[model samples]
Target: MKASTISLIIHGVDVDVVYKKVKYLRIGVYPPLGQVRVSAPTRFGHEQVRLAVIERLPWILRQREHFQTVERQSRREMVSGESHVVFGAAHRLQVIEQPGRERVEADADHLLLFVQAGSTPEHRLALLERWLREQLRQAVIALIAVWEQRLQVTVPQWTIRQMKTRWGSCNPQTRRISFNSELARKPPHCLEYIVVHEMAHYFHDGHGDGFTGFMDSHLPDWRSQRRELNKR
Candidate 1:
């Protein structure tokens, strides 16, 4: 069956409406900007979909508020002696300036960033981002190895990159995953849940009953992990 798309504005909120061959209506609020999306049966008219959105107005607003809170807490300022998160632990960043190769080392409580002398803030931030990507890489590699054995599916490739909203995404078609580098700043368990969630897509493509069942059976604590991960 073919699908159609349309835009909507309810109570000053922008929504994306998708009409498809579905049994019922479904609404979702995505991260980054709390994008509102509605999926409805093609049989439903525009007014019917609008009424459904109106009925769920309060719930939609609440979800948007939650997204805003998470965003504010995730903001980072790359500087010395600033608090940074790695592997779910808080570490103070110690920026060291010297005429040496730029590198980063981490101990229990500190991230020692050795940078070339007289580096700009942008340069420092870029170096830190690169380091964070590497950190996420190592962690993801270890987690994927364990999950591949348990789930019995191999991931061909994965990349760590900055994402505005999602923690991770899977392109099952390509057998590749894109992980949010910011996960390095979140709790370790939270990162684990994201990895598992994305890998589950190898079997289930959407957040439907099948996907939920897959997650519940494999990572029973995923719901709690998601709640904690969304907390400010």
Candidate 2:
């Protein structure tokens, strides 16, 4: 079969799907695994595709479960006295109402949540969250610059925001990357891992063998950093 032709069994029936531009198609089944693709084309058959994708239905189900686990793990309500990660270190938020200051500050060990004396708790929380996001954005930009030099890749644009399940995603076509701003709270290495991971996508658009090889060749400790990041 041509590389563009994809075949699989679904609902006790075998189906073949083809892509007009795809030059290769490969599938595999492994533990804790699902569909890991490296497609050169963006278009594919829809109806027959359903049947083709069903061969990995078990893996897809496992991936969904893992996604849910990560989603639950990433939830953190910004609250006073709650412990939060900062640069991979744990710190407690200390709410303080001052006479004049309306900004939040992070000291060596604690996040000093300051607000106007008459400000409501909700307002204080909002201010703190916004401040944290700004801090994360700055850190992400700095990190991206450092990695762009280290990896010899250029990213045209990127954004930092709180993501529900993914640490980051890369749009090869646009040469843009989006990272979970929550990473600012994680360890510095975690941030580096994400930046490098996205940079790799610039060369290999998908998470395939080539992607893994690139990561291994560039950062041998990537797996460790990834594991640590997930733990947080």
Candidate 3:
């Protein structure tokens, strides 16, 4: 019997199922988890593949729900009582009202945020974000110096900015690395791992076996730090 392909709409999203060679039916979704792809062997017809995907539909819905929950949780916009990351540690800001200038200072524990007596919450948040970025810049430079020596690589330029998704990115062609400014709020090891990861890219452009080997040899805990960074 000749196998056929089919397409169907699941949860208002279109999914295409294909029949290929030498494989049992398999279903998986991409990052946002709203769509599923089904692949099956030539011996199996599209109907069978569709049924398998239908069976797994509940699991897919659960995965999508989980993704949405996490996404909502990760979008912290710097409000009072909202947690901010510093050196990978979660710190809640203590918003203090002041009579004059807006200022930010850190004590042995929490970040002390002071704003002009009449200043609004928005102003205070902006001031704090600026201070955080400055701290991040200093820390990034320090980490770069350490890794340049440790990895025996030279990075010509680097920038720290707030990135919505990725913690860091590197341009191997230009020897420039850009790190998410929010990293300053995370743990020190997280910063180090990101710096090292970008530095490693200076040597290996792709995340292949060579890249993994290089990272493993240089920083054995790199994987753990990466996991922790993402978990937050």
* Best-matching candidate per TM-score: 1
Candidate 1, TM-score vs. the true structure? 0.75
Would you list the C-alpha lDDT of every candidate in the order shown? 0.85, 0.68, 0.72
User: lDDT tens string, model 1, 1-232?
Assistant: 4566677888788888887779999999886547688999989999999899999999999998888787777656667878887867889999899886998899999999998887887788788878888888888999999999999999998998867556788887997899988788788899999999999989986566677889999999999998887555
Model 3: per-residue lDDT, tens digit, 1-232? 2333456775554565655554567776543324455667777755676677778888877865776676566654544676666665567778777687678887545777887666665677688779988988988888888888887778899998766446787887888899887687678898898888888888776555567788999999998987787662
Off by over 4 Å in 1: 1-77
Q: Enumerate clash totals for all models, in the order shown.
A: 0, 1, 8
Candidate 1 accuracy as lDDT: 0.85
Give every collision pair in model 2.
Answer: 88-186
Looking at candidate 1, the ten consecutive residues that score lowest on lDDT are: 70-79
Could you estimate the TM-score for every candidate? 0.75, 0.68, 0.67
- Between 2 and 3, whose lDDT is larger? 3
